[model samples]
Target: MADDYIIRTEGLTKQFKGFVAVRDVTLNVRRGTIHALIGPNGAGKTTVFNLVTKFLEPSAGRIVYNGDDITGSKPADIALKGMVRSFQISAVFPHLSVLENVRIALQRPTGLSFRFWKPDSVLDGLNDKARTLLRDVGLEEFEPVMAGELPYGRKRALEIATTLALDPELMLLDEPMAGMGHEDISRVSALIKTVAKNRTVLMVEHNLNVVSDLSDTITVLQRGEILAEGTYDEVSANPDVREAYMGTGHD
Candidate 1:
């Protein structure tokens, strides 16, 4: 049963300058599931993400990924272990074409990373694979376009394409639907679902509608602790969860 989970945190906690951000949290993400972590602002959602991804060292507790204890691992180390994360902000090279951006991501696995001096032809081998990833995220038409020239939603799609190029087994998405209109939210939500069919996803999201539609399970955090976790229907009906998250008018 333990092997069913791709990542697990036991008694995870974080402190900043004597202030506790996450406290005694034990989270489990099953393989091949879309799990959403939702809470109001300042609920330590991002802090939990940082701890799991090794962006910030846990003040106390342990993190296990794929049966290995990785509490003391660095961010890059986790990434190398098939755990890749995307930031809340769009993180694409502004000047690069969409195809070039994904090709760059593909380079790391081929031992060509940072060898910018290698002739452009050296990277031509990566183009077909990059184009396939672009088509996967519905950006095949934008491959020749500049990443920065994309509209907000398209840029997010490009970011997903680049993230996919890394061949991540566990993808951590931080606020993937922030600052979007209704249409953009619908588009990206569909993309997340498509990409998550085979791999696992753990996302920190504020949009309950998106969470309800896509999440296989939901974990609700409040004041740096898990308030409740279950299906969207189960947690939505809990009075305590309603008061702490939905009652506050958070969608």
Candidate 2:
């Protein structure tokens, strides 16, 4: 069973100055599945992402990715191992053109030092790759536009394109829909589903509507612990999950 899982955690825990943020939580994410982590405020959803991405060291537990024990590895190292994350806020070069942001990200997997001597023509191949990624994310027409000049939704799409440049196997997205208008949300939501076709996606989402539509499975957390885990219908009808988020059909 473990062999079929792309990301597996055993008794994962994180603490800050003796305050436990994530408890002993064991999780299994099937390969090529869009597994969502949902919860009310302060449930440690992002903390788990930080721990898995190695942005934070766990107080205790083991993190296994692709059948290897990778507990406490550096973020760069984890990313090189085919795991990548996107921030809640847009992470792109504000001054650079939309295409340059993705071109720079494509440079990472090459392991080449940033050299002033490298001619622009040397990166022609990478720029082509970046162009493909931009098109994949629906930014082909905006490639020459300064990244910051694009609309917020397109900026988010650019960041997703940047992550795709890494060619990740497992992707962690933290609230990919935060602060978006309805049209922006729909666009990003469709982009997310397209990206997940070839990768395993584990996301922390507050939009229950997105969860219902995009998630292959859902894990509901409450007060730093898991309340329920199942399909949308299964977890939605769960007494504990409904009570924690909504009060006994009051809404």
lDDT top scorer: 1
Best candidate (score: TM-score): 1
Tens digit of per-residue lDDT, candidate 1, span 94-127: 8989999999999999988646678879899999
lDDT of 2 at 166: 89
| Model 2 lDDT tens row, 46-123 | 888788888888888999999989996788888889999999999999998998788888888887554436777877
Model 2 vs truth, CA RMSD: 2.0
Question: What is the TM-score of candidate 2?
Answer: 0.95
**Stretches of candidate 1 above 4 Å error?**
246-251
Show the colliding residue pairs in model 1.
none
How many residue pairs clash in all the candidates, one count each?
A: 0, 0
